[model samples]
Target: MTQIPDVAVHHETVVPQAQQDITDGGPDMVQFVDGEGTRLERTPANTPYADIVEALTPEDGRSMYRDLVLVRRLDAEGHALQRQGELGLWPSLLGQEAAQVGAGRAMRSQDFAFPGYREHGVAWCRGIEPEQLLALFRGVDNGGWSPSELNYHLYTIVIGNQMLHATGYAMGMQRDGVVGTGDEERDAAVMAFTGDGGTAQGDFNESLVFAGVANAPLVIFVQNNQWAISEPNYKQFRVPPYQRAQGFGFPGIRVDGNDVLAVYAVTKAALDNARSGQGPTLIEAFTYRLGAHTTSDDPTKYRSAAEVDIWREKDPIKRMRGFLSQKGYADDAFYASVDREADELAVRVRTACQNMPEPSQERMFDEIYVDPHPVVEREKAQFLEYQAGFETEGAR
Candidate 1:
């Protein structure tokens, strides 16, 4: 069960006919249903909010359920591996699968993705190999994939660093004339994902400034999971996170992060707008972090069991399951099949982790310089000689 929030609906009329233009119309901030699973069916005028039940197709509903289940299982298995000392640390995406998968699915194959460290679900959605991600946690590699290979940049561990990278890439795309002109394949966009805590960093804000001024085809998808290592959402913003984007002169939307339909719809619209030369959009996926910040942090120390219990009711997986079951798109057998697939994936991840080999010392110095550098050459020679001195002492 997942808890729903109590939101009030206010209606207003736009008297000016000119202002009612739908082309440049604003988003509908929708809040229906309470945290307790009670439903509300009213839509305020001029607001873009839609009911979750009405927004999804049967297939889409089933897909969301499967996405949540598979991602959560992967996260859980990764955490278990960390505890077993197979991984140095793992960031659990236990509660945020809907936000990642929904937004990720909105991207085109040519569009690029910039992810923070915890966006394993986004990587998964982008067809990144699970072993490639595990290699990072296992300390066998910094990042194993090339950005051009998958249209996804390497995961940024430093808080808020990837925002600048995304903004810069979007600017390059704009300069290369890779955006607009109605060619969806050539007209591409970039998505930068960060968290609630990252919003406080200067890099995040600077990226927005750059993207807005350049009219870069980029979407800043902020996953507001309500905690930045024990700091609650209220401590960071008086209003919603999306409201901050208005200062940058672009449309900003706050959607139900747990509602996969809402995330997909909102992100798809945002990316389409960007690709069409409409500039940037900021989307705040309002969700919760149902697990520890990482394997090392204990939520029990800072958050109450009551709080956890409340969020548990609003589990994204459960909501999608409910929708799928109600729509007759999925049955017990379907869920069982998904579970079996996830189990197989877990075994694959484990096997991959066990087989990862240590990088050679010579390879580290090889890629450090493209052209010949005398200083680096001297250092490499000295390093090898120093190691050679200890060869008999079991140093390699």
Candidate 2:
């Protein structure tokens, strides 16, 4: 039995047996950095992906750092907006910045991505404006952008449903002659984003069966943020996600989710493998969520403050910034510039969110039916009448 870490114990003795190398993501995990922002020496397990990281220029590293900063700022603004009652709810991607940005930046323009509701970082990397995402959370639109235009699907609220949609889309790509075309511009693949908790859902398992059997061009990226809402990884499954992929007849790899360089290298290789018709691959990003699951949640009820503090030491943005600084890829000026941009972005997002026009009251009824229906019309009339009662009483 794998011993679980007991938070009730002293901080020094709180390490889990399964997590002895947690700082470096274990032997089975691909990692590029130690938790303190220092890069790790290449090892046999990570040697396969070393070239991808090696080929990245200093400018590339700086760009990724910039992305990490901006995405985190966008998420912070969203959380603040929810607390101030500006939005109905908001899911903050507080500690998953590196995992999303690295994977997002690795994709080619021709590739498509299907994401869970918390993939704001991926949306940013896909050229999606923060305002568009804010619109959805503001309850102003189903989704503010066109999926076809951006190659990013609408956020899937039903847990693990997008995995099915992604697999079907990947299969469709296979039918369309886009996979293994031997043309960099022509070959395309699909990526599906979900969290560890989603692996328990039937849809997730079913999608894997189809993807593996058909050898579909799909990459299932699971961000194991230590908890699915309030449940920890141990409770979700006896086996980790990456290990389970082998049972489905494909390769699986675990990466240090907080290490952007490692995440980028592994994801790029996986995408390339899929595009080349090598079939599906599962990537488990081992990371932590340092915030509540959502604005409506209170994480302190289930987890310990000591646990949160431990993960805080592994902050993704800080790690990237440290790498850039040590390598002299980015100086003080560049860091300052990114910080200024993040602040400006936060202001812009806040203004746009507050200014979103309230959708027409009749829009609910209009959206429910494409043409016209007697039942919908009757309900709409009754709703409008009921709403007008306050106005009638105010007139007195």
Candidate 3:
């Protein structure tokens, strides 16, 4: 059997020169960790984010670290499954894990989440097991789990449908008389996840209109991973997505999406405000997608290798672990233990994926007028008869 290499060696822990003090993305972006693995001494003004990060008990910090590590492993395993033909397709959520987990963990249990197709990380945070995410791509079922059970709707394939679903849900939550209830436990908000490309969809704009008019308690979390499936963000929108919220009469904020700490802080605050009866907030998580749009995509066609390398140095898991190690929040032993857990997770996911039941040919003709269909029964019988007639596997 081939041996799996050490996770640490496989992942280069080097912090590049350009990444040092890397607020170079912009001074305006909210960031708690500078690229050099050092937590910034000061927090961004007007944001009580630092206090939140500071208040995290050591357990809270470690739990977030575990969330990032596990989800990244889940994503990597999905990509491998697709490449090996175990799955038909996969949308790699490599770099966006932090953005998803940070935002996901910040939500209250009562809050609802409407996620795009690529929200594996969010699904993890919402209490869905990692292996369940593969059922769709494995072709066993077009639709996987029941959304209502998890309060997380189905993975939406249509670009901007999630936004509309989220907005409509938020309005329903209001009509249900749950919003602004003095009891924090009863009051809840809706979180909608979308990509930069989805923002240009007509449904997205329409949803915004409805949300603005209804004053829905919704937080539109946009993970601006910089690529709308080979098309860069600049090609899709002229202005930063968050900035465009002003025209719709809602507040918008951009955060260092790659920095999980910033993402958690911003998302928590946004949800709190929304649940408090403040209108929707559009948060543009300025992050990058480290992998291709899907297993089949070749990002090299449009994006440059140098750009990928640059983002590599700012990897969400690496930086979070780096800062944690530097600040003594977690020791090397804890990180190693997490690495072992990640390796085990990857193996378990592979086994589960390999064992996923494939749909039978008969399943296609399954629901022909549920009451009863003589014609459907006749057709099924004919097909089976024809198959049984052939002795050779090729003929069958």
Best prediction by lDDT: 2
What would the per-residue lDDT of candidate 1 be over residues 8-72, giving only the tens digit for each residue? 22333433322332112134444343333344456551134353346567777677677778788
On a 0 to 1 TM-score scale, where does candidate 3 land against the true structure? 0.87
- Residue pairs with clashing backbones, model 3: none
Can you write out model 3's per-residue Cα lDDT over 234-309, one digit (the tens) per residue? 4676666777787787877778888888888878887887787877888889889988998889998987778888
In order of lDDT, best first, we have: 2, 3, 1
What local distance difference test score does each model get? 0.79, 0.88, 0.82
Writing each residue's lDDT as its tens digit, candidate 2 over 205-300 gives 999999999999999999999889998776777777888887888888889999999999989998998998988889999998889999999999
Q: How much is the lDDT of residue 291 in candidate 1? A: 91
TM-score of each model, in listed order: 0.86, 0.91, 0.87
Q: How accurate is candidate 3 locally (lDDT)?
A: 0.82
Q: What is the lDDT of residue 95 in candidate 3?
A: 87
Mark the 10 consecutive residues where model 1 has the least summed lDDT.
Answer: 1-10
Q: Predict model 1's lDDT versus the native.
A: 0.79
The lDDT of model 2 is 0.88
